[model samples]
Target: MANLIFPSDFEWGAATAAYQIEGAAAEDGKGKSIWDTFTHQKGNILNNDTGDIACDHYHRYQEDIALMKEIGLDTYRFSISWPRVLPAGKGKVNQKGIDFYKRLVNQLLEAGIKPAATLYHWDLPEQLQLKGGWENRDTIYYFQEYAELMYSELGDLVPRWITHNEPFVVSMVGNLFGEHAPGYQDYNKALQVAHNLLVSHGLAVDSFRESGIKGEIGITLNLNHVYAKTDSKEDQQAKDYCDAFNNRWFLDPVFKAKYPTKLLALYQDKFGGFEIETGDMEIISREIDFLGINYYSRAVVEYAEDELLKHKTIKPEQAIYTAMNWEVYPDGLRDLLIRLNKEYTDKEIFITENGAAFADQLAADGQVHDQPRVDYLREHFKAAYQAIEAGVPLAGYYVWSLLDNFEWAFGYSKRFGIIHVDYQNQQQRTLKDSAKMFKQVIADNGLTD
Candidate 1:
């Protein structure tokens, strides 16, 4: 198993989002986020699961940090709750909400674990959505204000910060495609949200600099190394659509400051443009210090006339699938890293999230045998190392999660954590196999000898 050693300076961390982990949906005067309303709607969430209590990380954060210490994690990347802090999206600051994060960050620092903070993870304040969500331009300004507030408070302690997580899924998939919260089903509207999110990202980035914040700033994107299901002309077009859907939609605007030509054709005639504010790209394209990437699996595209999305989607393939039914294509990891290096060419990269979910069950002895997840981590870690060998500047790898929290629409059912959570008693601990493997890997610093 030990083939390629990780760089001695490589970072080893784990990730978690706000809504997915920090439950207490209505505690301490926290405002409702889009996800709060979405889960309330009939059929919006599986088993009508909501993050009302989640892992209760809000209350059990100390216990969670203890678990991280047990597993020997170096860093813990988590997101801040936007609505929870600014109830109406930007008027009054909730000291209570701010206090929650202060405690979490201090605990991590005390534990000798680096804290990586993501500004937004799609838990937009419902008040903002009511005022038109990402479709409205004002949200960007509001987000800048929120980022400034966060940096003013915690920038001294937390050294790493991420602006937003995967606009492709939240703005396009959630709002545009009507699959997630603040749900709407208009392609043009989705573009508006996507553009606005980037605008907000730039504003936040600038806010970080103007405030003289310390440490690094970046964004987390869910990039899919997509491929055409076949060589036919139609299939190629399908793949092209997939590219627009997955990679180009976010990357083109962020890196090149231009929308993908094909993607523009699909919406420019309908919606004007999102990141059109002057001097915004100067911030968006600013020399960032690092990049965080969340890679789950490969997505194949074949022609499909869907009702909402209306192009193509993942097709049947003979690859192993995750519990979420995503195909496990290790090469896609290496491919994406190479492309990112070629594209950005200016920032360091971190595999912020790379983990698989399977139907895991606690055994009679209270341990879960997760060989699939072990194989996934091993292979992708090597893929990351391959990217490093190819000069990708790949710096670290963080498993998708430290604990299995709420999986949004899928709720608590989908487990992606190295540590399992017993929701009943709010007990948290680590799995035997994955924890053991991770400890040795961290101790060795790399799989290679």
Candidate 2:
């Protein structure tokens, strides 16, 4: 293969969530988040692991920022812990929490790296969860307040802001499937939660505008291309439904300003309707600066009469799989990007989260030789470059993480970072082979095979 070239202005960065990395669960006046409460429940998370001290990023953000600089990152995307900023979820502000983020942003700026801050990454304050969480319409107002506070405090320092990360996962995984924090298994509630999350996104964007902040704001969505298992009509129908549920369910409202009618009809019988309040769609459709896409793999769907969505995912036998059991399909990224550029709004797109989790190990040389990850990233970068050449307005790409932190329900079992973090040995950080390759890619503004 020839060298893969990227735009000179293409942004290179790494991303991490607050709860997944900033493990100061109970320090500096930080209140407990739903994850803190959820992980405390027995048998909730794998290996009974919690993020109490995951990466200790709360105390070592400077060191982490230094590592990011060493990796030649142009930007660093991280989430702000809602509970940390507002201990009770609203009203009084936590000055200590505010100071921490301010310090982190300043350090990144001093290091010549741009800061991209995500307002909410599913770490809703436990108190807010007690008040019905995202399902409760009131949470939207709380989110707006939180967003405004952050913007007022660090809006000038951070150039890029993401309102929410993967609202579909927050709804389906956390609410419907009961796999994440504030777990519940009610379809009706899940639909409501999904709506509320979108509403909060719009509200946050509105707040950003009202603040006169000179920065870009958008929401990050986890999207996948859905493919039919066969040419049969049933399989095609399954693919259509799965695409709507996984991608359009969130995409349409933001870009098209309305929920996909087919999905609405499919769920109407169970819940009567989406219960979309008047003017909710208008708020949800507020124009934004850009769109953040988190692509992983394509979904191969086959018709399944017994499944609620009438779809079943089937992994190809010959395909490579990630530690998360996702197929390693780089073409899916190109397809998804082109589809988004053509079907959705022609807004700027950023690959806010991409990278695979693999079982990485530290060799005797005190280095992590994660070749699989390096290959995964290279293929995906090539895919992204193909999309760019094909006319997608992809502005940047941020790898999934900067360090291997807590992997939510899977705990710390999955490693998705180019840089390895030894959780046992005082959170020792080591740059894996992938990190060195990424540094070269960043420096060259492309991959030189």
Candidate 3:
């Protein structure tokens, strides 16, 4: 078999969120975030684990960047903690917080690794949440202000900026499902939150252009292809609705400047609809330089009369499963990429987040024999190569994480990093076999069969 080669300019890297890795939670006059509040509450996160000292990256970023250099990464994608910078989410800059990110960016540059910064990754400042959070339109401007601050401070150092990471997850999981921070159990609220997030994203794009920053700006969405469980019309309809809910609900607004008509009608009829201010859609549809996608698995759905979306996802027993219980469907990435290219905007695409978790342990030789993770990444890389072959302008790939820090609601139960972190032993970092494989892939820019 021929070797799967990527474009010569293809970028390779890894990603991590601030709250998940940079644990100096309350140090340096940083304000509390929703995650901080949620994690502290009992019966919220698994194992009662919190991100209080996750990976201790705040004090160990130098070491982490050294690891990134050792991995031969072309770039490193990390998020900024909202509360870390703006203690009240809008007013009064925390110089310490701003200084910390400056240090991190400078170090990445020194290591010859380009830095990609994500403005938001679900860590809303607790102070803002108290004021109705994203449900209130005022939060949109606050976010824009925050965006401007980041741009003015570090825009010259970081060339790539992602406005938000997975707004769907931020709205649906955090609001509707009540699994994440600022937990609320109302679909109506979730819809409002989602709309506000898009508005804020648009405002951020506007700010970026206005600031005359030379960096590229985009949003990272968690997108997956939806499949019908059967040939029945009911299943097909369910698939369409699921697609609208998961993919098009966000995609259409950013790319086409409109919501899916059917879903919009259903939402209006069922929940009285969210308020779409005049010109909001136009703002949300601002032209972006690229589209960042986080593809992990596919969705297979069947119709259900009593279901909320009138659909229910069905898991196939024949599929391989990740530790997160997500199916390992590499072909879904290829199909999703092709579909996005044929249907969505013509912007250059990047896999901003893609990786899986498995139950692997350190062996006697002080090496982690994570063969499953190695295989998982290899198959996904092949799928990405196939997407590029199909004329998709795939420009880069960033693994889900560079360290096994905090895993959110599931806490530290799920490990999604190539480098294992020994939390019990002062967060000792050890590169698993998968990391070794990735280093080679980055060096070769391809994989051999």
User: What lDDT would each prediction earn against the true structure?
Assistant: 0.83, 0.94, 0.95
Candidate 1 lDDT score at position 374: 85
Which candidate model has the greater lDDT, 2 or 3?
A: 3
Model 2 weakest lDDT span, ten residues long:
266-275
TM-score of each: 0.94, 0.99, 0.99
As for candidate 3, its clashing pairs are none
**Candidate 1 residue lDDT tens string, 216-261:** 9988888888777779887777777777778877777678876778
lDDT of 2 by residue, 1-449 (tens): 88888888899999999999999899999999999999999899999999999899999999999999999999999999999999999988999999999999999999999999999999999999998998889999999999989999999999999999999999999999999988899899999999999999999998899899898999999999999999999999999999999999999999888998888987997678667888899999999999999999999999999987889999899899999999999999999999999988698999999999999999999999998999999999999999999999999999988999999999999999888999988899999999999999999899886
Candidate 2, residue 449: how far the Cα is off, in Å: 3.3
Candidate 3 Cα misplacement greater than 4 A, ranges: none
| Residue 153 lDDT (model 2) | 95
Tens-digit per-residue lDDT, 262-354, candidate 3? 999999999999989999999999999999999999999999989868899999988899999999999999999999999996789999999
Clashes of 2: 0
Per lDDT, what order, best first? Answer: 3, 2, 1
